[model samples]
Target: MAKNSEKAVKKTTNKIVKSADNSGTKCLEDKNYKIENPLDEEYVNEVHVSDFMKALAYDPVKGVDTSNAEHISAWTDALPVRGTTSSTKNQKKPSKRKLREQEAAKPKGISHSLLQYPLIFMIGLIMFIELIAYISLRQIVRIWENVFSWRGKKRTLRNNLRASKTYKEWCESADALDNYMHKDEWKKTIPFAYYDYRLLQKVVKHLKMYRQGDTMEDATKLMDVLYVCLKQNFAGIENAKLYSNTYLGTKALIEEYVEEVTRSIEALASNKYISIEEKRLAFKLYSKNYGRTAFCLSGGAGFGYYHLGVIRALLDRGLLPSIITGTSAGSLMGAIVCSRTDEELDLILNPELSSRIRICQDNWPTKLYRLVTQGSLFDAEQWCREAMWFCKGSLTFKEAYERTGRIFNVSVIPYDPHSPPKLLNYITAPDCVVWSAVLASAAIPGILNPVVLMQKKRNSEHLIPYNYGHKFKDGSLSTDIPTLALNTQFNVNYTIVSQVNPHVHVFFYANQGSPGRPVTHLEGRGWRGGFLASTIEQMLKLDLAKWLKVLRSLKLLPTVNDQDWSSVWLQKFDGNVTILPKSDLSDWLHTIADPDADRLKKLMGSGQIRTWPKISMISNRMRIESCIEKVRRLLRTSPKSNRVGRFNSYSDAEIEKLSQHLEQHDTTNNYANNSDAGSGDELVFLSRRRVSMPDGSFQHLQDKDSIKEQNRRRKFMAQFLDSPKEGNNSTQSSVLFDSHSDDSDSHSPPPSSPEDYTHN
Candidate 1:
């Protein structure tokens, strides 16, 4: 009976149901079973009022629409499945042949007919337009072809030459002419030397031989050849006078011509850099006989923008230095000036590139990380890469020197404080890589890691300055301004120091009348109290103070801060030209790591403006010197042959008279003086006080009869001189060389002497 009761209890307990009261859930009634016990009413009510139901009943905020169950279900049911579309359920694509047939069968209007053949019609119209253009503007096309097309111009010139019967016959006897010229013998004299000038001279001589026989057309062609040769070989040939049948004057008139040609050849021989404008100025200043100039650029971090302005001014004034010494940031500018030509420098220094090159911007955290780990705040490799890119190619120190004919020295100090600074240049380290040297020179201590040059390859130890282990730091620590370093290697007659350091006194001329005055009010800005700024400031101050003390010991430092101090100092130290930024631009000097490109450009412009007046003054002074030299040379020349010889009897009055004559004949195109006086043609100064020789010795005329004799001799020579007979003056000597002669000696001979022009 107990077991039966237990089974009935279990069945009854299973039948009991639990549900929320508000949900309206009804329990199913069964005839076979009945509930024994049920969940408590309070517990059921608590379950219904729980936090879970409250979360489901929560309403969202504005702009949020609650989902409609009915609508979502209905929309999902109506949506199409894969490979089926609801909008185009019954549509079918037409067959290709049927579509084509339909398109062809359509009735065509004027517009439809045109549309069918649109591409063809447009092409026909374009061709018609081109034909009309060709018919109407053929002459213009020909003119453009003749002027701009190299092949067309060359062909035209060649055809014109061929039109001359004598020239045509001359071309046929190339063998005979070659035999007479003996080019093989000449080539054996000076290997790798230029012979175009000599060959051109020979051609002129041949043309002179046929002067009576050749037609005017042939002669004009010969003149055209001469013009082409001059334009090609010489840098500044626009102002040159080419000889024709009417204007083949005496050899004296063409002495300058020969000299210019020879100078161009010499430029090639010596591997000196040359450009059109530079060569023009070179020709003008050929008589100056100036000594080698050394440019000493100081390290001032980004203040090197001032150096750019100085360089531009120097180049613009035609005072390119033969030696450049730089430290730290200045080394970068020095490398650029040494490795690249003026044209390349001009391109690199465009406003966009110049500004971008100054400072690199990086995050503070990244900078800190790099400073700790890499021993540098910035990626100096990027700077080097950009420098190499600007130069287009990498060159060794020796190669750069050979190509530019300018000595480049970069100052760098080793880790040892006791050791003196090493000047990395061609002479000191010939095989050192230029960009690497630049990197070593610019590597600032604490700020940048010392450039490590390891012996990566065998026999490549000499590729860098040091042989073994040595870390190179910034050049500023050893020598901030390496003025004396350059003088040690070369005879630096003139020193150009570009100083942008903020602590140094910027001594500039107050006016033309006053000598110079120090800009005492100028001071560094935005860098006070900073660790780097303060430390560097103190170091610079100490260095300068020591130098001042040394100068004082030598009695070269002036105590009085007055206008006369500059003159007195200059008198004591004659060859140094110091260019300083003015007080207004002092703010730029302290911005060592400036990131603004526009500010850098502005700073560079300021430097140019500050330097222009001084450069102009120097240029004028040099021009005056050149004029004096020219006059002296003319006075000393033998009247019969236009050769220089000692003439002690020549008086200063004759020299002064010649100067006056030169001033009268001075054309607007022949002279330029970039001075504040605003006269480009006024190069010759009349005042005795203004005109002083380079040696500081002034000359005055005393013997009146000697001046008359000089004039009379010149006149007498001009009246009685006669041109030489061409056949009697043939000096071409054929020196035979063995056929098995070494290829090393197969170079053209030296240029013909001045006497070679006597016959012509």
Candidate 2:
């Protein structure tokens, strides 16, 4: 019986061992094995079991008791550092629902996303404050200006239009422009100016290197043709001369019968006489619009007024200056007022407007705002933008370039310390012109920060075909007339690149050498008393000849060849440009008083020029020396350099004979005679009539008699300029000629002039 019982016990022990071994293998295979405890019902299936734990966790259901000392010790070791006390093992595990309820019973808190509301609200409030401040200030300024706006000297418009031109005048303009148009060299010259000749040649060579070099000639011609087509279709050249100028008051004196004058002007436009475009040209000239006028603003704050005054004078006199350029503040103002109406100018000059837009801050609001965004007290870009806004009266410069035909230019410096500045214009694209120039201009080393701008370039094959760039600043430190610094053959193809020159006009503030003094025409006929004037004269006298000699020495024009390479210091110096007011200029203006000196002066001053308009009534009188300098610069510097001479460079007799021959050839066209109604005799008639009548002013024209006299003037002018051509000539000169009477219209014939027959 004992042996059988012992056998049973051994069998039981073997069975239990087999079960423990099986559980260990299962634990290894299944990482998520669980241990069950009857006391811990809530923890059912939740307790993790390791391979080692399999040895210790014997199942109660199996009834394989851990009564052996070894088994008991292994189980105790696996129970954790502090063996499970009675209270610990008896504790039940909580269910998911019960835990969730316990979590709900704890405290709740705010979320991160929700916490952002107050911050957002604060930002919005700050922006609202800034907007309100900017707007309110602008309104205040507008009202202040309307009350104290400047009023320049009002002079009666001078009546200078002549009814007819002598033959010499007609020959000059027509011969040069018309004859030159047909020549292959001149034809290419125009296009050469539109594109860089060297670059164009390189392209041609590249396209044909594998083939005959000459083989690409046809392709080049085709490209030229395409460029011409593009220019006509997209460029703003044809309409460039158009501008809004107050009409000349003198027109009222001669426009007696409105319909009659209207008919005459219309007749001038007829194909039978001058073409419509020519008629417009003539009208513009009569209105005092220079053929190609440019208004350049300098970098001065208060100085803008002087520029505006000059512009206003130009407008009042109906002067048309098609090209507009500016630098620094000048650039800002030019972009702001380029296409503005007369009334709109009032809004531009408002003080509050200046306060808002000033790049350098005196006020706290703009400064504070700038500090916040730029992470400092000043930001160059923001300042430039504000300055533009102050001048532009708008956020973007698109509205600033509203004049359809006018050329707009702004000066900017490359952000790179080594790169030279350039003139930027909107003809390329509006965005390219404004921001690039404005920001670069304000990259004042110590003052404003530099800015980046978008640059667009075309890739022939790609639809978008463009890229952008930024990294430039205000260009005032370098070239003053950035446009003038360009090559003589600089691009003029309006469809592709802007051909406009950027002339600078400085307007200094009170603290900045000018006291923000409102201009009211200079007094004392513009004095020459100050030490400044005398010093200038002495400087001119001392150094004028040196200037003339240097100017005369150039083999080519300063435009074609600059003397900069001759200076060793300039070659070695690596520094930002320094612009100073001209002093000791005598070296450049020697022999200015001499008649022959003009020739030399013109050469030296031809490429680049600086001038102060005597108008606008500024308190500062441009000394008479300034006027002398102006004239000196206008002269021909080098006597040896003779590229071309005037049209009627010949004697009076020869020019007169040429004119008569042209008239005879146009017999089929019924050309008017010199004694016709529009002839110089009209002036004789007017002078004789003036003795018997009141002055032919606008006031006098209200009466019927004055009206009749005015009618006569218009009728005669129309007959002079709009009459059918009765002459033609085989000579190239035949293309343009004027008829003149041997018999004087007055005591002496009006001085024979090339201007008499001004080309339309």
Candidate 3:
């Protein structure tokens, strides 16, 4: 019985072990293992055999009997439950109330179909429609505004042009336009507006030609149609101002007018008589729009005054100054003001006296009776008569006479039935004649003789007053004479007038030198003065047989052989050398050669070159000179020696000097020192130099010059007898000699040089 019992206990122990192992494995695999107290009533129903075995295995009380079947079963029944309770709870079915509650918790009426569509497409479509509408509206507004503005501008321009009396003067303008337009070469030389002017002229000519063959009414209709078409295609007077000063437009108009007037004047002067009516009409047109013409010529404002003065002078002298009436008045005024005499001016104005001149009311058939009245005696008969009626009581004419006499320099006399003194009308001054002649000569293509016209006007005093007035039926005076005469002299001579010459004037200022400096002042004067002087000199040498060669030598012009003339002006020098070119020399000479040479000398004498840092200047000059010399030398050497290596292999003295110069000039130090025997030795030396030596150990050589001298001596010695003999000296012999020398050199002290010691 004892053996069987022991065996049973062993068998139970084996079974418990197996069950525990299985339960532990299962727990690990299932990942839901849980421990429960064996005494807990809640865990009793779910207890398993595997749970009991696991509890027995975990609690190892040595005497506990695990072999009894009933005890084991009881223990199993009391084993802690893990998954049994969970499984039983999980197996319970949902109640009807719980199902209803879960159903109520879910969201209702949510749809995702439309949400799946791309938002980008919807947004893009909406934006595209909005953009299309916006653009359409913008375009409509632009078109409306453009049309309205264009019409308004056109109307305003037409009114201004109609008011201008200069329209008649432009009758011959088409001819001038034709001349410019017909030439194909002119299309290349002239601008688009110039060509357009030619086209317009052609169209007008064609219409006129057609009119000559048609009835007046038919011609008029055709002209109207043509004019309308032309106006539509080409900008009218309204747009003239906008394009007048721009590029070719205004210039072409002025040029055409000038050409036409010049041609007409030439024809008239050549005895090709233009009708008096035509002359009168032209003058009226020109005079009415004189202001605009003057504005065009003078650029504007102050210039216009100058130009008008010139035009007035020209008109007084019987010259066709109308051609340049608008464009060049200001320039002409400047010329007159700058150079005309008072007497000359008076002659051109042709101020004159008049007698028996009558005044008529603008709209009355009845004339007001008045006697020769008081006022300035110099007043014209017309003025005298007007003043007589206007005066209240016995008005003194002395003041009026005096003012008129002072202004016009002519005396007025009463109208006489018998023995009428020769009546003077217009006032012509000498300056006015000169101004007119200049303007006419510049504007018209002819030889103008103002002297003859003045003489004729002076001689014709009896037939008509100097002002060319005759009594009319209404007793009012009327001037039938052309105020200005057109000279018959036609010449092709033209002169250019401009304030600035681009070629000779350096417009850029950045490169100009400092004030008071020679180079700076030379640059400041611009290239004009130098170019002028050189040009004059070249002109003088025109007779030379080798003019081209001479010019090349002078460097006055570029060479046909492709040689760069600019090189002559370029300064050639190294960092140490300063070589001022001949051009600069010429400029300097010219500067000092001014008529006020003494003043220039004084100015130069007031300062000295040494006023600044002398050493720096000297060093810089030296560096430049040295560099120049080195370059020249290098050039002189073989081309093969032009390599950087060849140049770098300079002597120590040269390199040292270069380094000193570079340092003085504030250049970077990049040169290698000859004393650096090798890179390793140099590095070692550098390291040694960086570290501080122990105090009082040894005195370092402080004098660099002395050290250099010592090094020179050592180099000299090593270069002499210390060198190895030619090959064939045995290695043993060499070693023996070295050993001997080492023993001797170690024992012997260094030989003393003359510079080693110095006496106080």
Model 3, range 1-760, lDDT digits (tens) per residue? 2232334333432332232222111221232333232111121111222222222222111213343312111112234222110111121344586467554643344242232233334544554564454345434543643454235544344334223222121112312322333321221232332124443343334443443443433332332222122111122212222121211112233233222333322222111122222222222212111111110122121112222222332232222111121112222333322232333333221111001112222222111111112111121222222322222111112221121211111111112111121212112222121222222211211111011001112332111111111110100011001011100010101111111111111111111111111111131233222444324323332222133233333434422212223222121101110111111123333321221323222221111111111111222222222332232222222132112233435652464444442331111011112112223332222121221135513233455644564454334323211112221121110110112321111111111221221210
**Which model scores highest in TM-score?**
1
Model 2 — which ten-residue stretch has the worst lDDT?
Answer: 241-250
Better model by TM-score: candidate 1 vs candidate 3 = 1
Off by over 4 Å in 3: 1-184, 187-202, 221-292, 295-760
lDDT of model 2 at position 718? 35
Model 1: residue 612 alpha-carbon error in angstroms:
1.0
Q: Residues 524-573, candidate 2, lDDT per residue (tens digit)?
A: 11212233432433343223222323323331112111112111110111
What global local distance difference test value does model 1 have? 0.40
Q: What is the C-alpha RMSD of each candidate to the true structure, in Å?
A: 42.8, 41.7, 60.1
Candidate 1 lands at a TM-score of 0.38
Per-candidate TM-scores read: 0.38, 0.31, 0.16
**lDDT by residue (tens digit), candidate 1, 82-180:** 111121113234458646755564555776455545544554465455444433343443354345432543444434332322212222232122223
User: Worst 10-residue stretch by lDDT in candidate 3?
Assistant: 474-483
**Model 1 misses residue 133 by how many Å?**
80
Q: Give the CA lDDT, 0 to 100, for residue 16 in model 2.
A: 23
